[model samples]
Target: MTTEAETLARTVLSVENLSAWYAESKVLHGISFDVREGELLTLIGRNGAGKTTTLRSIMGIVKKRTGSITFNGDQLIGRRIYEIARKGIGYCPEERAIFSSLSVKENLTLPPVLQSGGMGDEELLEAFPNLRSRASSQGTKLSGGEQQMLAIARILRTGSRFLLLDEPSEGLAPVVVKEIGELILRLKARGFTIILVEQNLRFAKRVADRHVVVENGKVVDILSAAQLDSDMERVQSYLGV
Candidate 1:
């Protein structure tokens, strides 16, 4: 069993009583969670449950946010989005933001390095082999799976230790989804801490160490991967699946 001291030592990000809003509309309501170093945690819920808002709140994208967001011992609540990113936190939005004008290679190398630990070009190419073949192709020219891979690959080049991935498996084929899952597992093995926002429960169960269930903008339950099997009824109710 993991001891308290070990868990404390391993925690890389902590969010307590986090609330957020867009313009006048409130989204996340006093949600709290912690992501341990190198652990893959997923935020699971149906539409409008505020899973995406929680990620936006963490990245400092949501301007009107309350409560503590501590990452690597640094307070992130008041920081700018770019500043938060500079602190080694990366956000990959649901849209899979890939610059259409830039080639795959250009897009991959475009992000300014945030830290010294980023993977080199060759290493990155090795990890995402599909990228190497499409090096000269425009970013928007790639298929959905390739675009998703490039979106994530660019972040790896930025040297971000903690990644906030939103809807990575959404609208992808089963084979491609499996590939993405394999990639996530590889990242976890390489010590990349990730918080994934996913509506796909099957995909979440495949890669996440824990699941944080959200409903009506609040965290309703936290379950381990093991507990997921036995607690399906409750999970389904929260997800309305």
Candidate 2:
């Protein structure tokens, strides 16, 4: 009984009653949300509010998790980390996690392509011109911005349709942050869906289509960009900004 419009507007990812823990301490408490295909959604909150934990749980990185995480109609809760990844979800942790020992080229080419339609090395280099210049340099030798760029660009080669980016703009120079923002916009234009964990509200406002506010390990609010603009006072109160 699904209408054509509803089918066209189907969610690419869905999480319901999702809870996670580190050892014995529960971090996320029944967090739930949906991400439409090609939408840019952001998780924003004060420190230790479980924004990153949600992303990790979605990627199966946080093994001690409960509830449902479905992607394109497939259940992901019990899947292995690699199994989940091969289902076309790419993760860029807050740490960037570039291989310190590998050259930029090597790091960029390392991940095996998990699906069709991934960008080739040349295409990725063209998209991130600075990476082309640092091709021969070790990952550790790159600037903070370049390292973050490498972290994101490396995943594009995997043909991932969904991207979980954790604090991508954290600790970067303003100019570098602007560049990363532009890059994200570009990726969105190419029909990629993204879930971002951003501490910089200003930056998130510029790139995200919608915002999900998390507090005390739960999704406390969901707002469209327009709603956020009009209700920023309430949003700021929730974020304790």
Candidate 3:
């Protein structure tokens, strides 16, 4: 059952006219979007188009950022990174950072105990059965796709309501990609709100409820899944995918 906190959720994550800089270099211009309850939103664009930076800014990892970012009705402009995480936002970067020396179970349990309503290892194992099989293996021993699955699954232990996933389909075999796509859909069906940053149009087309196209550091268009299903050419021209 979806709680009032999840429903009437209006917007779990909202960014308005956001901008960011690394030292003197401006990376993101004024970009804005919203992730509603249980929605699977995605950001797509070319390399260097500021997709990753946008996620980093939302997580408060950027050196400097400006504009209004609100999570669950609280202003996030000046919050620390962990503070933001505590507000129920989990981020998985493109690199899939895992502890190479630790076993899969250990890596999953390493994060600070969360205070919100995300998934646990047992539940995540049910969501990704392959993870259950590899639970005792060292992180380095897993294949690339397994590592990616572990990385995203581990973030669930943080108890986040909103997940920001970066290029989750990158560099995986088609079979692995298909599995990842299914994991994302199952997450959505379970009422987890996700904002995925993807370059793979096929993967995004499968999972996204809505699509936001970013170009030259700004969101240029917003399209529904229905729109994408009806017209791939329009989306492809914006993304060159």
How far residue 147's Cα lies from its native spot in candidate 3, in Å, is 0.6
Clashing pairs in 3: 118-159
Taken over the whole model, the C-alpha lDDT of each candidate is 0.92, 0.94, 0.88
Estimate, for each residue in 1-241, the C-alpha lDDT of model 1 and write its tens digit: 3445446657899999999999999888899989898889999999999999999988888889999999988999999999999999989999999999899999999999889899888999999999999999999999999999999999999999899999999999999999999999999999899999999998999998889999888999999887887778989988887
- The candidates, ranked best first by lDDT, are 2, 1, 3
| lDDT (Cα, tens digit) per residue for candidate 2, span 1-241 | 3235434876999999999999999999999999988889999999999999999999999999999999999999989999999999999999999998899999999999999999999999999999998899999899999999999999999999899999999999999999999999999999999999998999999999889999999999988888888898999998788
Candidate 3 on 1-241: residue-level lDDT in tens? 2335434657877899999998999989999998898899999999899999999999999959999999889999899998888888888988898898899888887876576566766777887788788889998789999999999888888888689999999999999999999989988998889999999998999998888999988999888888888888988898776
Candidate 2, residue 236: Cα displacement in angstroms equals: 0.8
Model 3 scores worst on lDDT over the 10 consecutive residues at 1-10
Clashes of 2: 0
TM-score of candidate 3 on Cα atoms, chains taken together: 0.92
Q: How well does each candidate superpose onto the true structure, as a TM-score?
A: 0.96, 0.96, 0.92
Name the runs in model 3 displaced over 4 angstroms: 1-9
Q: Quote the lDDT for 61 in model 2.
A: 91
